[model samples]
Target: MNANEVLLDAFGRIHEAVAATLQGIDGDSLSRRPAGTGNSIAWLIWHLSRVEDAQVASAGGLDQVWTSQGFAGRFDLPLSQRDTGYGHSSSQVDAVQARPELLLDYYDAVHRQTVEYLQTLGDDDFDRVVDTRWDPPVTLGVRLVSTVADCLQHVGQAAYAKGLGRKPD
Candidate 1:
């Protein structure tokens, strides 16, 4: 497979893995911080989704999807707030909580949008450097690969947290 096809195939499995993790999470478990060590499942999901929104929007020379929605007003500082990396506000979390289906929907939207955008590119676009809003100078393809890596890593974390309940075996 070529680079784009390889990325699409790998991301397809990552999508299934992420969906398995999200579906296994009970509502209460979504807010648990796991001994106060790091972000909860909800926070992690928000972060991952937002990362995709931000990165792809940057590539397209548009604003991120989350910011346009005024998500900052949903602040859930201190306890559920994220400090180390991107996270959602309290309202954003509530929004996500209100619609469990939106979790998968958002993930699917970002993934599909990214793949479609990449499909429009030629081999030249793969090497074309773009100054990313979130990262330093890197080609669009490189940035996308990084985003896929991020998604895969977080899916692993969520799977481990889910114990024996993870699916798609």
Candidate 2:
């Protein structure tokens, strides 16, 4: 498989894990930050989506969909504010799950945009090195893998917090 295909598979798996983990969680459960933590399921999803959006935007040298997609206004926060700490109120959690379909739609849009950006890249684009706010701003391929890893890790956290099952340590 090609680089884009590999990235797509990684992204798809992470999305699936997030969806499955959040499927039956109610507002209370979603808002609950595991003791000593400050991130709820809702916040995690929002943060993850924003990260993906920004990563794609950076890769494509274009603005991300945070505002264009109406996410900032809907969430009453700036796209630049990426604090994923817990401390979510019940209302916030309720709002997130209220329109589950919309969340899924937003995620799908982000994924499509990312794939499109990947398509625009040549072989060298994937291998080109760059600096990012991330610990090690590496090649585009490394960034894609890192993004997927971040998403999957948080999804597992959300699942474990809900007592669904112990996410792999």
Candidate 3:
């Protein structure tokens, strides 16, 4: 398989994990934090989707699905449109609550945009530098890989938190 195919496969795995983690979870369970300071399953999925949407869309020179697709309105989240859950305080995390379907819809929308963007890239496109802040700079391929890695980590976290039950009041 070519590089694009390989990359797509990696992203596909992340999507599968996300779906499995979210399956059968009710809104209450999704909003529950395993520990007082920990993130909830809902927050994990929402953050992952936002990160992927923002990072991938920026790399592709496209508007983020979050705003472009009206998810911000649908979610009506307390945070600003630019919020991607980075360094979110516990209060901010607690502000994120949604039904499982809405959470999955956002994730699926972001994933669709990600896959569509990836499909447009030629082999050489992957070599294009997308970030210069890093010491050696980062390529489009590397950036996409990083996105996948971050999403996978969050998916795993959600899965773990899903099993931990709600934090005691």
Q: What is the C-alpha RMSD of each candidate to the true structure, in Å?
A: 5.4, 5.0, 2.8
Maximum-lDDT candidate:
3
Local error of candidate 1 at 116, Å?
1.4
lDDT of 3 by residue, 1-169 (tens): 8888988898898889889988888877898887677899999999999999999998999999999999999999999999999999999999999888998899899989888988887899998998999979999988988988999899999998887764567
- Tell me the TM-score of each prediction against the true structure: 0.72, 0.75, 0.94
Looking at candidate 3, what is the lDDT of residue 147?
87
CA shift of 163, model 3, Å? 2.0
As for TM-score, the candidate ahead, 1 or 3, is 3
lDDT of 2 at 163: 79
Off by over 4 Å in 1: 67-99, 132-136, 164-169
Report the Cα lDDT for candidate 1.
0.64
Model 3 regions lying over 4 Å from their true place: 166-169
Which consecutive 10 residues in model 2 have the weakest lDDT in total? 77-86
lDDT-best of 1 and 2: 2
Worst 10 residues of 1 by lDDT: 75-84
lDDT of 2 at 110: 78
As for model 1, its CA RMSD to the true structure in angstroms is 5.4
**Relative to the true structure, how large is the alpha-carbon lDDT of every model?**
0.64, 0.67, 0.90
